[model samples]
Target chain A: MRHYEDIAVGERVELGSYTVTKAEIREFAEQYDPQPIHVDEAAARESVYGGLIASGWHTAAVCMRLLSEGFLNETASMGSPGLDELRWLAPVRPGDTLSASVEILDTRPSESREDRGYVKNRLVGRNQEGDDVISWEATNIIGRRP
Target chain B: MRHYEDIAVGERVELGSYTVTKAEIREFAEQYDPQPIHVDEAAARESVYGGLIASGWHTAAVCMRLLSEGFLNETASMGSPGLDELRWLAPVRPGDTLSASVEILDTRPSESREDRGYVKNRLVGRNQEGDDVISWEATNIIGRRP
Candidate 1:
């Protein structure tokens, strides 16, 4: 598992790929979002989205999945202070294939800690067409393994 | 129900405040986020967050609830293209009273369809201390009944 000591500026990681599905979107929406455009295809067709669309929250949750499978599970992450920015440029459709990439932008030791540091990472998601679907820079405090 | 024929620029909506509880945090974390720092107080005490903390996703979800109760339920909004930006500035903890405010920043109609327009909103969430916890800008495609 990677630790604070292992994170370095300029490090890059590819998080492979993910595909969006109508079932998943509908399920998530039914449980949490519950918007007409997210749940009912016919209602969505009559609505402004032009068609069924995924909830923005669902998109963010999908992003977290990528983070977990690609980085968090393999790291010494304590937790993040917060996100600096998150933008969803395009709709994540049921047929879209999304891939992710992350770059370590910076790292520093915590002022109050000798074994922990904060790392800033720029995470980006793109569709198969290479168009950026979402982007965020997150700051996480991590501990160095003794 | 709010329909598409109404809404003015500069509208400000006050979503009712909600009091966060530890049980709610734990339930949300267990089902949705489930990271150690968010789920286990003891583990969080040993981690960087220092205590059980709400997930960023949880904050966004709560924000959605406010929108539904305050604006979406009263507006003719169809859906959004997507979020322009999302920022989590602070941690929201149990016992915090979270309130949200949404301001209509801009409104414009489709050149070909005067009956339909889009609105951009700036939304901010604040805790009991009045500290901003999260902020976001989103685009919503609203309708104007002819």
Candidate 2:
């Protein structure tokens, strides 16, 4: 398994893409968000966005899926403390394909724990039209090589 | 509808609680996070957490549901730009009931737009034992009264 020692600062990895669907957007929104712009197409059209849009949380979850498939699955990931910041730069609409990527910004071995370290990365998702849809800086705990 | 003019800084609101289920935790993990500690009981038992736990995103989404039901539904919420910071303070496991709340921290009228303004709030979720499970600072766009 890829460990903390195996990764370095400045490394960038391309995560796979996901296409948002109208049905999935509505389903997720119905459960967690339920805002008019996310769940009701007609109301969304009358609102500021001018069309139905996916919930920001849904977009973040999609990016997490890509991160798991492309990077975290291969590593000895312990878990994450949380994110430093998150910005929904642009609206994610139905049928928009979002391609995601992560760039390692920094890595530091734990002072109190020898078995694990922290890896900081910047994650960004861009739509089919090349506009950034979401971005965040996250820190993950990765186990050291045994 | 409640508008930007209706809310005041330092206002605190209690969002309702939610009991997380094992099935729901695994479902969200399998779809998005899929981390072993979050999805597989056996694997999680061998991991540091020693048991299955909910994905951080799932916990955030649950909090979003409470926020929407308790507060956003009553206001002229346009949408959120995003959050400033998020920290998962403690692990969330199956059967854990989390109660959420939000306190308005600041508000600013948009310089370029008379139709809307920004509301900044601190959101927090505490488990049954009163331990904070997650917290974040988020900013939302709220429409002005017509």
Task: Using DockQ, give the best candidate's number.
Answer: 2
Candidate maximizing lDDT: 2
Q: Say which docking band candidate 1 falls in.
A: acceptable
Categorize the docking of model 2.
high
TM-score of each: 0.77, 0.99
Q: Candidate 2 chain B: minimum summed lDDT over ten consecutive residues — where?
A: B78-87
Could you give candidate 1's per-residue lDDT for residues B1-146 as a string of tens digits? 65554666788989877777899888777655667777889988887567887877888878876886678756766666666457778888887889999998887887887767878898899998899998888887777775
Compute the lDDT for candidate 2.
Answer: 0.96
DockQ of candidates 1 onward, in order? Answer: 0.32, 0.87
| Position A7, candidate 1: lDDT | 86
Question: Candidate 2: where is the Cα deviation over 4 Å?
Answer: none
Tens digits of per-residue lDDT for model 2, B41-120: 99999999999999999999999999998999899999999897799999999999999999999999999999999999
Output the lDDT of residue B63, model 2. 98
